[model samples]
Target: MKPFSKLREECGVFGAALRSGEAAGLTYNALLALQHRGQEGAGIAVAREGAVFCRKEVGLVSEVFDGRALESLGRAGLAIGHVRYSTTGQNICENTQPMVIEYLRGRIATAHNGNIVNALELKRKLTEHGCVFVGTGDTEVIATLIAYEALRAAAPSPDPGTAPADPAPSALSAPAAPDSAVEAAVVRAAKQLVGAFSLVVLTPDKVIALRDGTGFRPLCLGRSAEGYAVASESCALDSAGFTFVRDIRPGEMVVITPEGVTSRQVLPAARQGFCVFEYVYFARTDSVLDGQSVYQARYEMGRMLAAEHPANAEVVCGVPDSGLEAAAGYAAESGLPLVSGFVKNRYIGRSFIFPSQAQREAAVRLKLNPLSFNVAGKRVVLVDDSIVRGTTSRKIIASIRAAGAKEVHMRISSPPFRHACHFGTDIDDEKALIANNMTIEEVARHIGADSLGYISPAGLKTACVHGSLPLCMGCFTGEYPLFVGRHTKTQLETR
Candidate 1:
């Protein structure tokens, strides 16, 4: 058992092409801003002098990348970085990203967000074609597929002397015009892939940003004095001192070079399936994804939750990090006083890699402690983002009760998580989820809460400011945006 009760956000990817600032250093800062997306592993790959220099390890960004590691990456024109939580792979260094590779054409390093639906089938086919893998991670698999396709698209027919094939005359067909071919190859590879993905790929001269056709994951483009930056959230862009540009639309790819930026729509315009949970939990409250402010959306979620599930409590307090915004909304809507019920340790990283469930449960108290002075003898309304296994919640409630809280009403900002998330969340299989088998009342009892209330499905939808963009609610609804199913979360890691 993973010992985590909340769904883990998969990965955060950041890419930059800079004219002045060092790509690696600026990206390190960007990763720090985007670290909440994942804490299992961290990595950065820089394209320097046409070869890639990379340093990656399984740990939080700060813990994994030391001053020497940053120095090893040095400065480069183009760089890509990733902070990962293992949705598709296991928590291991081999699964850490910024998956770099070499091919007949040149070097390309890629950092990816989102999971591939057909990764297992793709791996089988690639293996039969003589591709050997170092680790069972979809990011590495994707990098290999892109490299192979790029080489294939650029390769010409063999000659009698066994020399490389000659190129045609047009700009698009010319061999020396390498970036165009690579971009086209990337677009082709993107078309072949199914399911959600947001990729930031780095070559020697350019940084490429891509989003899946349906845009199940967030990827946005921004501009800086140095050049361009692409990240999982606009907050990372702001951290890098970049001006917010529009999102890299679904099915779109942008190639950024010293000459400027060029765009291509690989897939036709379609309904956007932007992840709604980004606003609900994963994204920075400051980020605007798909034209909607995440903070405003979360505030709306709190208001909606209050409208549907009103509680008679003296004070409302949200979970330390993401739930805070919603907590404010709840307080404003219900006219109840809001106060801090628990104080979290800012230095403690997410315990995704704890060796055992017992250790993880024990470590929970170290990360968050109840404010006995505030919570004592009060009817406390505890708000949190979506919960799964109920292990962590039980711990939190037990501590609060031990501190002399009179009543604890558990309120979730999102609906019950009954289904597995196949896109990028690590929640997989009904057996692992307490909600899959237990009713809301049963769950409240299991977690030691006095009462429990969840935001309804419609309430969750209307809470987002994503006006017309369709959102992926598959995890709560048991309906997927894409056409793939039955695969296990750890299967990719097992390979």
Candidate 2:
């Protein structure tokens, strides 16, 4: 809860399948562990006897689901959950996940993390073909696609003489097993999807998960005592009593049923494009993603920052919660004493509550206080993960000066966010990013720091242990790995 700066999580997803009892409780717990990913809304949905039961609202997970509410979901064979910070949609109950629907293949409760670049086009096509739309969010679009595809996959061929008299094909009926039919439908829908996504689907007999071919977001499988669970981060799985299984490969679909786990590769694995922000800010410090330790990556980023941009200071301090590990690494590399600069108020939280620009600007002090004893009269080097608009960083620097620090040099661990993010990390407007407009020198003056330095893209990659994987550095380099829309390409046209 410390380090009350602003970095947002686009969304988080969790699901469990083929368990003995109600899985909503486990889903709820997973959401708690992932609460950092979002705070605007929360929901959980369960599938029981070919029907879906969902309860959701705009609030924190604890505020949305209580013991009584979890009890209401009752015992179910499968369940899926979601916590979201909107990037492509507005905040509304209708937009909250998991989006449940009844199609030809019984019913399903679906949850998703990441934005859909082609959501508008797909929704338009679905509507032209007679699919009635309810919510404006992309999750609903994905649900509808799966429903229609499942219906098509389950539809029996026109055996003119032997065609069934039924008006609609029963999704659970012959040709293939019901579970298999649902999974095929999911694969079909996933193929049509374009952009970042880690989807969790709940059917009557199985729980299914699908990750985008690029793997721009994190998704992993875990083995629980009762069954299998999937989450955007393994820490959540660990919190839910699931042992870490390997991360689900890119473009892979993993199905968990009573028979255990099964998987199929839908897309040819091409280049891997994981979000570097996960290691820097989105994921918990204790979690690991894509074979790299987030804590180690951050620690190394600090060490690398110290090596590349050593600051002349008596002591080094980190912006709590986010920059602590890196500060330690910086201290180790520079051989400077590490100290706590700010004490964060755990009671205050989740920046969205301060809606207005003025309110948000003032919130910095309400959440963090510079410790005079730790920083007084010392030339201190302040290390932070990233500075979005430089608003809070400016305020924090002013506070440190007021608290008696002789000189405050700001050291950032990641490259500047110069472009908008389209695949769901929540910085969609380029103008809102300070780095897009300010030079390194200009930014330092604006933030009231003696000097400022950000980790170079190459340095950041090295710190994260990035090897041959093709990373999504669009926000930094303006070079998108894959193209989705003309507008998206045009925005990153400078590179």
Candidate 3:
């Protein structure tokens, strides 16, 4: 059976460069904070004394990294970690990230957090050039490309049978240090990429943070008394006691070394395409993305939603978690009382991960139950981040009605998904998306809601106006930032 229907972001990446203390432990804590971005698998790679040790598995961070696992990683001053929900590969152990590649020059570890549109094309070229691969994930392909570039740069030019006379010492410039070569190699590899990616790399001498040219994914630089850190979101930095340094710009490369931090624009940025859904649903409420507060954005979205779609309801209730803040704004704007209408089972993981139809249905039921006291006998404005397939939303509204609610009105904080997302978001088949085929009124009827309203693209822009750049609404509109070509998750996996 197909998995439960919901939009899923690819993954989250965290990297730390500490002057002292265990970087691996800090990475673990940061990964916990980023767990919401991805929950299928977790991994961490630590560098110590010029050696990189990686521990990864197909499970939650807490499940995969026990006391023994952390100890096995040993003490390290530099580390990078990743939590993954596969968009281009299966949710298996081999695809878990922090891909460590050992080359003639040195070793480097990479943790990536987005999909690569041309990964298969790049993989084919690499294979033709005799690059062997282990995992089917795009991250491995990326790491191998970096290693290939670094090695190719470091390798002595193929035997020119007749050697030219050596130039005078003063006439020739010194060869690049291993660290400099690796940084340049990353820039080269990044320039060849054609999709969303915010990745962190642990080199032999430094930690590198690189974001795609379009800034399709969020990545930031942070600092503390000990050293510097880079994370997919600012909230992860906070978990490790790091204060927010400025966000890494689009196509920028920030290298953290023992000497200090240095930055350069590795690739000239294309159009600013930061994902708008980060505010709508993906990021943690506490995270600040590209100078905008996630919580503030969601609150504003809710306020806009209320203004656009006023529900004649007595009480406002948010779908648990992401929807709560928006619900608060809706309640505040509509002058309706905001109450917790559902009791959530905190221990249950995201319902979308359940594989079987029966299991997914059960997960939804076990995950949240309508609180009869608040929702019963009252008109309810039900606020949620989105409705992907309409199945979960239908189930939720049915549960509320079963609890005796007089009327349930549905409100979404973002525009409907009318197109497929070519970036990291797993909005694969347009045919599978409910909004793609059904009109607003049709969707409302299908989902059993008395009324339904979706925040307009304009309203979403207004709410997220604080962002440093323009938003990517390709999933809402057909216009995308880059040439998506014929890329799909299935093609990425099979190729």
Candidate 4:
């Protein structure tokens, strides 16, 4: 296996409703709060008196859903939204979600927050059976699978007693009844899926939220005076003025209607394996996942790293964004002066769009400018969340050196990534991972740092304070929690 490299983000899903009025605005607000989870695409799906209307585009939520688009989406009692980061395929306009599928029974709009590992295999099977795909996203594969199962479940049986509820002739073109038949069909379809996923589906009459058995991603439920809401993070719900109800249990499926919410178990309960990286890198500091504060967890990680690898340096600085909290913790623990060594340009979006290596390097300069006063003639301890390809780290280190730092030591908060992640995380092939190609000493030299250290796997687990559950540390240990095929070679060749 090649070394694990930084992968793109999966996506974020948000759904909401107000009992008294339209939910499009609330859903928009929720999407904005969850925007950190993805930046490539955004969309909203609304249902008004059984009619589903949607507006989606390839851009940030603020750019995609303007007044005109919102007006076209119209008012609705229920709405579901999505912010996307491509994991399975290239990011494109057609791949923006929440994907709306109008089936024979009713219209269903779905937004998903994780990758389905077996999606390619399932998509092939479905395609051979005459299923047509509109986009190259895994969410579409899931939607098509559900539609197929629902249609099969709707088939008339030789024994009338076992037949699914037949739609009334007058209601043939309307939404199907939200009865056991439809729920059973959903459960059956869910069973066929493999990998991490937290999904919210909007039907003509109800909203359904489901999490994979292992619960690798976070999904929470909330309530407002209007109705119920489901979001990828509690922060989004809080921003949208909803009270946190609870997290969707692992392997649990929930259906919410005007009457009440119903729960069903599609898989047996097992040990929870929520991703520890959510606290370290993925989730926003203001959010909580699996009952743990993301900010606190990251702070603890920095504290632990300092205890393990205290550096004698004049100033301690962190990489922008993800590493800031950890740097603070390191500074506090090491009693080193915390200084802002680099000023990051808040305007730059994702790094993938920088057309060339020189442009990408220039982007780094534009995104972060070294503060001469902070590092001139001083020994610097640089704290970063992780080092994937070592490209960004190399640039930052060179910049710090150029700013007159006497010596620079790099400290990483997470264990070295040695294997690829098959879950929804964007870790690509292992060959691109610095840890795979170079030892710690080599990596230090490659990045032009005086010294380097990484948090041990044990340290990471300790930081999360998750004792009862096992973590999927595949990226660090090369031991996958589940069966992921031998595609690493193929992935590497393509890369």
> Relative to the true structure, how large is the alpha-carbon lDDT of every model?
0.81, 0.81, 0.85, 0.78
Pull out the clashing pairs in model 3. none
Instruction: Write model 1 residue lDDT over 320-381, tens digit each, in one string.
Output: 78889888989899999998978889865554467887776667668788889888999988
The 10-residue segment with the lowest total lDDT in model 4: 486-495
lDDT of 1 at 484: 72
- The global Cα lDDT (0 to 1) of model 1 is 0.81
Q: What is the C-alpha RMSD of each candidate to the true structure, in Å?
A: 4.7, 5.2, 5.2, 4.2
Q: Over the stretch 102-215, how does candidate 3's per-residue lDDT look in tens digits?
A: 754356899898889888988897777677777788998888777656633443444222122322322112233277666766776787788989989897667999999899
Alpha-carbon TM-score of each model against the true structure: 0.92, 0.91, 0.93, 0.91
Supply candidate 2's per-residue lDDT for 47: 76
Tens digits of per-residue lDDT, candidate 2, 308-339, equal 99988999999888799999999999999999
Candidate 2 vs 4: which has more lDDT = 2
Give the candidate number with the greatest TM-score: 3
Model 4, 1-495: lDDT tens per residue? 222234445888987755755689888898999888888899999878776778888889999988888888777778899998776655777678888777555677878987787787777877766777767777888876666556545555453223243333333233453434456556666777877889888877677889988888898888877788888999999998989988888889988765567786776547557776787788888887778788877888889999998887888998888888899988999999999989988777654476677875756788889998999999999998998899888989999899999999899989988777777776766666778899999999999999998988888888888423467777888776667785421231121
What lDDT score is found at residue 332 in candidate 4? Answer: 92
Q: List the residue pairs that clash in candidate 4.
A: 2-430, 2-431, 3-430, 3-431, 4-430, 7-426, 19-226
Off by over 4 Å in 1: 1-3, 155-177, 269-271, 350-362
Better of 2 and 3 by lDDT: 3
